[model samples]
Target: MFLNTILNSIIQIIFFAALPFIWWLLSARKRIPFTQWIGLKPWKDRSTHLGVWIAGISAAFTAVGLALLFAFQGTETAVSVFSGRGIQAVPAVAVYAVLNTSFPEELLFRGFLLKRLQAQFGFVAANITQSLLFGLLHGALFLGTAGVGKTVLLVLFTAAIAWFMGYINEQKADGSILPSWIIHAVSNLVSGLCAAYGVL
Candidate 1:
């Protein structure tokens, strides 16, 4: 299980981290700026600053809610999904995961994909599409168990969360991914801790 988890994590990291570069190369034919595809910009507005705090708090509550929901419902699969690894080892892996999982995943799903798709398709369409893809990415975790339904629910829940965060990132109109990053990191950290301690 540990080996499988580690391998899965590595693959996920590589896949997401390479996404921007892959998309950039493909979209380069159309002359789209790399920054636009990567969602890079300067943070010049106060709203972006405010968003950091708001999103952070929202992430905290969201983590708590997810933990409680999984715990009360006796969903062992959901609780154990991301737990086996030791927290002390997280830092070493986190440096890579932060870039690969957090930043690039957000950049690909929320930044490049969501923004570009939204321009071509409306807001609702973009949100739903990206959210579904986000959910599908976790399909492997739900294999061979009744956890599939719970996994889908969790993914949909996360999708809704991502939609809101994506909106904030877009509205900020600045280069700062700080708000969303903070929210994502905190939410994951809290969720992992809770699950590890069996509090979830």
Candidate 2:
């Protein structure tokens, strides 16, 4: 199950990477650096500013809180590949949560789709669209295990978080994904840890 968990994460990361790579090949090809184009640049000056701190910290807390809520439930709603695997899965699950799950997601949604949509429709519309899509994707993934009520909650929570992530990246982080990535990575790590302990 642990090995399968890692494999599933890898598959998701690959799927996320492939979407932007295909777009890169179709448009800029090798002209624009793919990493930078996708907001993989290192920390910006504003990345450490007060506003960034507030946004990042609060969002991380919210995610962690939601995760804890589900963990307390100790039901199917607390979906994770590491679920029921116990502490033995912690080390690998921790790595996967940060690297495979959160990293690629930020790259794809906040980095690729948000920017693409922003260019075409401005920030407000773009953020909403990408957030909705992000929420829908998660909703679909959790529908079977989380059930209708929890899945609806997941969709709303995910969309709100995604929008906030995009907002911070664009407004506070100078379009860098670093802030959102860090928040996402931390959130995933905590959630994965809970799951590894069979709390979620």
The local distance difference test score of each candidate is 0.60, 0.76
Candidate 1, residue 93: Cα displacement in angstroms equals 7.0
lDDT of 1 at 158: 63
Candidate 1 Cα deviation (angstroms), residue 148: 4.9
lDDT of 2 by residue, 1-200 (tens): 55766777788888889989889889987688888888888655643474557456656655644664563374443245567777788777776767776888898999999999999999999999999999999788767866788778878888888888888788777788877888887777677677678664
Clashing residue pairs in candidate 1 are: 41-175
Off by over 4 Å in 2: 1-6, 50-79, 84-86
Q: Give the alpha carbon lDDT tens digit for every residue of 83-183 in model 1.
A: 54556435433443344356656767876677768879977788778767876665445534536666666566666667666766666645345556656
Q: Give each model a TM-score.
A: 0.68, 0.82
Return the lDDT, model 1, position 34: 64
